[model samples]
Target: MTTATMSKPSVGFEKLSMRGVTRSYAKAAAPALSHLDLELARGEFVALLGPSGCGKSTALACMAGLQPLTSGSIWRDDVRLDTLPPEKRGFGMVFQNYALFPHMSVQKNVEFGLSMRRVPKAQRHERALRALKMVQLEEHAGKLPSQLSGGQQQRVAIARALAIDPEIVLMDEPLSNLDAALRIEMRTEIKRLYQERGLTVLYVTHDQEEALSLATRLVVLRKGVLEQTGTPQEVYTNPASAYVAGFMGYRNLFPAKVENTGPGDDISVVAHGTVLHGTSRAASGTANGAAVSVAIRPEDLVVAGQSTGNSIKAMAEVVEYHGRELSVQARTGPDTVLHLKTNEPVVAGAVLHLGVVPDRVLVYPADDGEETVQPHV
Candidate 1:
């Protein structure tokens, strides 16, 4: 059987690309990665995103040549990358643990790669200091990693990666170990470096917000399979499937049937004896009575005073006070619970009239057997 592949728009020079890449452990029934095809253009910040164990790290490892693919090939333009070893691939790597030698000073750690390559000591020292300056750590060059804070240590790691002047940089959750404040600080630093140096970066992260904020494009995976690939706006505003919509933080998902579809793209769906009308974003026609899944974000549901023919009457069950908004849990129907976000404060045990904007609802073809829904708060 032929393998399935995903293609990207070739706007610039293609720096790294993978085709039908799969990695399977011994005796494991399923592969860690399955026929995944992806590409990275020159200077693009691409984020490999998914939940834990979804093969984000494995994919990054394969790209760095740390782990060989069980099948398929990786390429840098016409050059096959699978034939090279990790050291020979010339791709810089930043780890979550900040892999720096404690015994070595920050400058020495940054210059280690150059020293290993047998470069002249003078040139190595110069490049190391340059990298340190780039990360704004030149003053800390004499200090050891243990002397610096977590954020500073991460900067040293980044400087070390940049010291080699590699064509590509691969990061495996580099900010996962840092505290909330430091993570935000490092995120800005990384973006600054990306802009200043124009590095082609492939970052692996489980944090959807991180990927959405940092990446030029996002490749989302689930169960080792490619769910969707698009820019943050494209994926967040228009998820292609229920799985992707859930992953992107859509809390309201329901199983329904297509009761009718109007010529102007208006769609009517029914669930548990409740009929809802909305507009369909999909261009493909759906036959009447076809089973489908409808997804909506909590923020998209507006709280109104009365039912506007398309509105539903829901009683508030719980109210969570966020700094800027309130998260209200309400029961809309006998079997349906809806989560809505509003700037207005809502008290528990109060009744709320909710209306969903027609164009905001997304409808997808239903899965055949079991349906999986991930609700995020």
Candidate 2:
């Protein structure tokens, strides 16, 4: 692989805006994406994150012109973008599959987009080699896709996308096919490319951790509707709704009734016959006896010592040793189970008093027909 730096692509835009973007298929019961309004600033790394069928990929496809919108418009700065064809839009795309030509050499694959654009042969060759070098795969330029590993092929796909010097790169779960270790390695490589090239990216993924670690901002969707949009820190620390809170690794979620509103966004609630205090985004005007849901992350639960602000007494039903801590599933009521983690050695059937800081607990208005939190497999 060559280490020589290539000239940066001259592409910059103030913002790319999507206004009420909606897509529907005749055979489908509902639209795949619905009324999505989003904006991407120059050089921003935005991740579209959610579970399967949450419209993340659909949104990317709509933006890439692979799928036509049912109703809505996309704009680049002041220019209307949805009116243009995919090739004419001047955007690069990487798919979940590497999507490389099996018969073509790696260099030829990287040069295909340029060739389509009628770039000169000499210029396309130089750009292809430079793009390959960017991915550290220039040495494999002559090899067919069949000869390279999954990671190398993915890199070649990335190089192919970058070779076109697109204004924005749209990635649809590009790393989902790679193994766990390769996924991490490619994440670093992609981040480096984004920072070094100052590339604007709109990425799609169902993995929460991937989005949290790589994205400058996260756009979370549910059933084709936009759920929340915020920085990773903001979303992880303070989710806008119970659905988002469950998706963000809040393992324990249960129904609670608001008891009173305290000073400064603090709220008191009663769950499973125990009183608990937590911070609420809607605490300012929350009425007493209002239905609410309480969410707490497993790592935030601690074995109670002397201080007891919010405490629950339960019997541990299952205990498993993690590398650095013990994971416990405790039963607090006939139908209530709470998951928590602690550093202390614990065994099944042991009585444990779990406590959580008020700030760590999140309270949201109760949602009807909300899905339970499922462990990510």
Off by over 4 Å in 1: 1-14, 118-153, 280-284, 333-335, 368-377
Q: What residue runs in model 2 are displaced by over 4 Å at the alpha carbon?
A: 1-4, 119-140, 146-152, 372-377
Q: Output the number of the lDDT-best candidate.
A: 2
In model 1, what lDDT does residue 318 have? 85
User: In model 1, which range of ten residues has the least summed lDDT?
Assistant: 1-10
Q: What local distance difference test score does each model get?
A: 0.82, 0.87
Q: Estimate each model's TM-score.
A: 0.86, 0.90
- lDDT per residue for candidate 1 within 1-377, as digits (tens), equals 11112122223346688999999999988999999999998988999888777888889988888788999899988999898988877788997778899999999999999898898999899888887876668999999899999877887888788787666789998887778886776788677667666678999988888888789999998878888899989998888778788778788877889999988778988863567787665548888999888887899888887767666678999899888999998986778898889986678888887888787877778854544546333
**Residue 163: error of model 2 in Å?**
2.8
Which structure among the candidates has the greatest TM-score? 2
